[model samples]
Target chain A: MQGIILSNETNALTLAELPKPTLKPGQCLVKLSAAALNRRDYWISVGKYPGIQPEVVLGSDGCGVVVDGPDTWKGKTVLINPNVNWGASEQHQSSDYSVLGMPTQGTLAEYIAVDEDRLMQKPVHLSDEEGAALPLAGLTAFRATFVKAKVTAGKKVLVTGVGGGVSQMAAVMAIAAGAEVYVTSSSEDKLNKARKLGATAGFNYQGAEWVKEAKSVGGFDAIVDSAGGNALNDYLKLIKPGGKIVHYGSTTGKPQELDLFRLFWSQASIIGSTMGSDREFEQMVAFVEEHQIRPAIDGVYALSSGVEAIERMADSSQFGKTVIRMEA
Target chain B: MQGIILSNETNALTLAELPKPTLKPGQCLVKLSAAALNRRDYWISVGKYPGIQPEVVLGSDGCGVVVDGPDTWKGKTVLINPNVNWGASEQHQSSDYSVLGMPTQGTLAEYIAVDEDRLMQKPVHLSDEEGAALPLAGLTAFRATFVKAKVTAGKKVLVTGVGGGVSQMAAVMAIAAGAEVYVTSSSEDKLNKARKLGATAGFNYQGAEWVKEAKSVGGFDAIVDSAGGNALNDYLKLIKPGGKIVHYGSTTGKPQELDLFRLFWSQASIIGSTMGSDREFEQMVAFVEEHQIRPAIDGVYALSSGVEAIERMADSSQFGKTVIRMEA
Candidate 1:
């Protein structure tokens, strides 16, 4: 089987032939159809992420066909959960819990083995590419916007960095939940694209008065943000009293200043959310199916061209998920 | 009428003869028996607090006799809810919300004119001094622990800076709610006092390995903290996965380095809580009544000795609330 392996020595990702995986009890062998790239994958390849294990297959989001699993899962089209060893509690993941594509093998291969419970039937309306895109970014956005922020109908929501996969999904999920969704992007083109995707409005964050512009739209009930830095202070100004800012990633690094006075005085909350729990993943899939939502695909690459896909993600110009077709 | 007034010119607090306050419609006049000092009062005296108004009687927590009011309240013993103009929202206070002892005249006066709705019957079990100590700190602690952290039976709660009024109240509230409460304080005497107040254990934060010592007891399910600085990162390490760190004050100033990686990966939450809503104040009073909890009073000062009390609070040596007896 051919898989994308992250090299520890050279700090590069390359396609290599790997032995077929043996499935133990409670595990299933999956023939992957497609997989998607996340910013973590690019970081891992460049040796910028923590726990960078060399020789590990790289991909946390994938869609595949189950060839050997429980009677119920045989021949089913499923999406991988990516997260493993979540343990018993729902409040948080266990200390040893890990996402796929790190120390353990991942779905960036023609054949991969995963726990049976980690497989869920792909939403019937989505294609394999879209299904692969839904796991990592979708679950993250779902948990951050809905679970952490508790976004609901008539509530105003803001998604920062709208061109990113997770931010786009956050906007989509909030909109599908009947929220008035707004987005912020550095590029006007991306902002327009977000507006076309059902956002109530869009702001160019590069503008000197973007915070004022957002405030004019009315203080957001919830702000879904990935960029965490000095920008976090601006969020305090744009948030309605008692509103929440749900952060899943800190791409801009640690926040330099969090206005403690504004935080407590306005009764605002800063919620840190990551990938969804198993239950939340199920809810996300159900929501996508019920709404017939298709994750936007920015570009697709053949299996042998995985390097190109990773490079594109590194460029940070893609507006949506970049996918790799396993058999192309 | 005699009142402790914050001077506009010198930023000094001095006892002065003032005219008796006339009650307006929907207002009640209270003859304050006692009032408690918060750190905010000291900050205001030094011109460190925002919106400090001269001639404002500076005391947010008071217990007194309702001398003039509607048919039901003429002779009742009541504790004034220092928070005024809380508006209608349970989620957050309105724009007009102001704490007593600020721009608005407060309870340091021999007589205070307050909205009738701000008065709640004092718990029969408490003396004037104890009841006076309960309003600000008790309300802040109540909202932080029960409302924000949702502390429940058998849960582990940590209250930092345990000697302070809010921290002490948090420890008591969590204990009364059936939680296993721990406390951190620099002074051994303060820690011992907290343990006597029902903390399961106490840690001396002055020690180099305090985080390790706290971990030996167990990971905290919730931490009520006022010190927000580099120590906040240590809290993330001490908290159980999915736990919350509820902050009401930033006594140590803004946090320099917030570990965003640990925050999201562990799904930990940093919640900002402040003075409770009117509904929350009622709930806090009800909780206190049910638990028969008495707020700890450190020392008593006469109304004429208000300047001394402020100095004592500034020294940060008191183990609990320092109160002023209005009639003295």
Candidate 2:
């Protein structure tokens, strides 16, 4: 079988011939049609992610066909749930929980073995590329927006760093849920693109008076953020009383100069979230199907050119998910 | 009438002669027997609090007997709810919300005019001094513990800076609610006092590696904190997955070096709260009555010596609430 593996010998991710995985009880063989890149994959490739194991397949998002499993799952087109060992608690993941692709062998392969329960029927409205994009980023955005922030209709929501996969998904989902969605981006092009996707407005964060401008209009009921640093203080200023700031990633990697006075006085909440649980994954897929949501695709690469897809992600210029086709 | 007023002439708080408050429709005149000091009062005295209006009375917590009101309560013993104009929302206070001290006239006067709804029956278990100590600190602690953190039986709770009024009240309330409570303090004397109040354990935060020591025992399901500088990073490390860090004050007045990675992966929430809403104040008083909980009073000072009491609070050495008796 052909797979994209983080090669121990070369210290790089490369296409290599690997043995086909044998199915255990309750396990199914998935012939992956497409896979997608996330910031998690980029971090792992750069050796910045924790618990990186060599020789493991390197994708958490995939759309595939189940070749061997119980009668209910056999021959079904599916999107894989990347969350593994989610355990019992809906409040948080268990101690043993791990995402797919690093420590556990993942889905960037021609043939991958997965538990039957990890497979969900691919949304009929989506192509294989879009289906692949919908698992990890979709679930993450869904949980952060819906569960953590409790974003609903008539609420105003802000999605920061709108070019990223999860951030874009959050903006799209909030808009789909009838929210007044706003976005921020350093790139004017990304801001324009977000506006075309039904964002009520876009703020160019590079502007000197962006926070002031944002506050001038009105405060947001919820702010979905990935960049967490001095910018968080600005969020404290812009969030309404009793608003929620839900952060899934801290791309800036610095301490926050949060204004505690504003926070307590306004009774704001700063919540931290990551990838969602299995139940959230199901809800995300259902939402995508019901809304007929099409994921924004950046560029697609063939299996042989998978390295180029990761390079595009590393430069941080891609506006959406970069995908890899299994067939050349 | 005698009152402790923030005198505009001297730019200081002093005992002065003032006209007794007259009742408005739906208002009651309460003859205050005792008033308690909070950090808010100290901040206003030093011109550190926002919206400091000179000539205003400078206390929020008070216990008194209603001298004149409607037929419902003309001669009832009561503890005044310092949370005024709390408005509608249970999630957060309204924009018009203000604690009783600052811009509005407050409880330090010999007579206070309050809305009928702002009065709660003083618990039979408490004296005038203890009832005065219970309103502001008790409401803030109740909101942080039961409302924000959702603490319950078998939960492990940590109360930081346990010597302060609100922190001590939080420790007591969590203990009364059947949580296994731990406390942190730089003073061994304060830690011993907290343990006597039913904390399961105490950590001397002055000791090097205090965070490590706290983590060695186990992570806390909820941490009630007031000091929100770099110590917040320590709380992130000590919090269990899905834990809540509820902060009501930030006496340190510094930015936080929070661990974003730990925060997101653990799925923790950092909630900010000030004085609770009217409903929460009512609930707090009810909880006190149900538990027969008496607030810990540090010292009783005569109203003429209120300046000395403020100085005691300014030094931050008081082990519990400092009360001022009206009779000298």
Candidate 3:
């Protein structure tokens, strides 16, 4: 099986041939078609992922065909939910929920083993790459906006840094759910794409008063913050009293400085969202099937070029998910 | 009407002669019988409340008989549910919301006028001083445990700084709800009292291995953090995967460093809980009255000694709520 491995050496990626994993009871062998990269993958390469082990497979989101599994789950195209619980009856019900690509060897190889409990059937209409993109980034956005922030219809929402996969997913999903959406990006080109993706308004984050501009749409009912630090603090102030800010990742290294008084005074909440549960992942796949919400595939590369994908993600200038087809 | 005013510019608890307040529609004028002191009242006196007017009355929890008001609220005996609506509604339509002593005139005076919406009917069996002690601190603990943390039967919980009002309430309620409760405090006396309050175990905060002590009881399912600073970070590390730390006050101030990667890896949450909502306050009153959970009162001071009450609250050598009785 072909895969990418991160060594102890910084900023290095190695292409390696690994032996295919054998399946255990309650486990299924997935014939990989496509896998998507997450920001954590890059950080893992640099030892920024806490307590990570070396010489492991480096991708998390993927779509695969169940080549071998429990009879109930065999021979179907599926999306493997990344959160893994090894030694537990249920995936989410376990004591330690490790995501693929972090502590567990992920889905980067041509053949991978995963628990049946965390596998969701992929929609037949979408390509493998699109399905691959939906698990981590899509579910992170889905949970943060809908489940955590409760971005119901008729609410105003802000999705910062709309160029990234999570932010773009947030903008599109919030719009589909009847929320009025706004987007911000440093590049006009990225803002233009956000407008095309149904953002009701778009702004340049580089502007001195983009916060003021975002608030001109009126105080947001919710803000999904993949872009953190001052951007998050500004969103906190821009939200209406009792509104919420759903945070997933802090791409910026800046520490979050929030006024504790403002938090209680407005009855507001700062909710942290990581990834969706197995059940939520299933629900997200169902939504993608019903709404035909395709994962925006900004670029597709072969397995050998995974480093290029990570570099694009680090640049923070990518428009959407970057998927790597596992075939040569 | 005679009221206590502090000599400090914000409180000025010297005796003052003023006309009794006239109530408007949806408003009630309560003749103060007693009020409870929270540590926040001291913050109010030092001109530290974030957005309050000077010479403000400084109490958040009190109980009294309504002297006069619009027909809708006249002649009612009530506990002032001091969580005031900084907005028109509370988080989730419940409506007891406020910055409390920080942003509004409080309940310390001999008489106070309040909107009809913020008062809860006094439970028939409790004294006014007991009822007064049930609002700010009681509701804060209730919501932090029940509403925000969703503590349930069979869960393991850790309540930090036991014997203070919220801490004691959390311990007692956890016991009533069938949870395994652990208490951490600097005082062995307070720790013993917590055991009497039904905590399964109590650990001294000074124990360098309190984290190990917490884990020995099975890593906590949820932690209520009234104790802050590096303590919060240590408590956070003790949370089991997918567990939570419900934070309300940060007595130790900001500057506690956090490892965000640990939070994400363990799926641990730091949820901020202020006081419970208006409806939550009413619900808490019913729960306590039914369960016969009389809040532990350490000492009662005549309203004339409010300054001394504040001093006692700031001293931290005492346990339970300190009440200031105005009538008897």
Task: Give the chain A TM-score for each candidate.
Answer: 0.98, 0.98, 0.93
* Pairs with backbone N, CA or C atoms under 3 Å apart (clashes), candidate 2: none
For all candidates, state DockQ relative to the true structure.
Answer: 0.74, 0.76, 0.25
In model 1, residue pairs whose N, Cα or C atoms come closer than 3 Å (at least 3 residues apart or on different chains), thus clashing, are: none
Docking class of 1: medium
Between candidates 2 and 3, name the one with more favorable DockQ. 2
What is the per-residue lDDT of model 2 for residues B1-328, given as tens digits with 9 covering 90 to 100?
8888888899888889999988899999999999999998888888898788888888999999999998797889999998878888898888788899778788887999999998988999999999999999999999999999999999999999999999999999999999999999999999999988899999999899899889987899999999887888889899999999988889987565667788889999999988898889988999999998888888999998998788768778888899999976
lDDT of 3 by residue, B1-328 (tens): 6654554443454555556666677788898888888877776555555554555567888889888776756677898877666344456334334544434556777888888888778888778878888887888889889887779999999999987888888888878889989988999999999898788889997988878877777688789876556675676578876677877777765423554545544556666677766678888988888887777888888877777678666668768789988864
Docking class of 3: acceptable
TM-score of B chain for each model?
0.98, 0.98, 0.91
Span of ten consecutive residues with least summed lDDT in model 2 chain B: B253-262
**Residue A283 miss distance in model 3 (angstroms):** 1.7
Assess every candidate by TM-score. Answer: 0.97, 0.98, 0.86
Best by TM-score: 2
Error of 3 at A107 (Å): 4.1
Error of 3 at A293 (Å): 1.4
lDDT of model 2 at position B157: 97
The backbone clash count of each candidate, in order, is 0, 0, 9
Fraction of native contacts under 8 Å reproduced by each candidate: 0.71, 0.79, 0.10
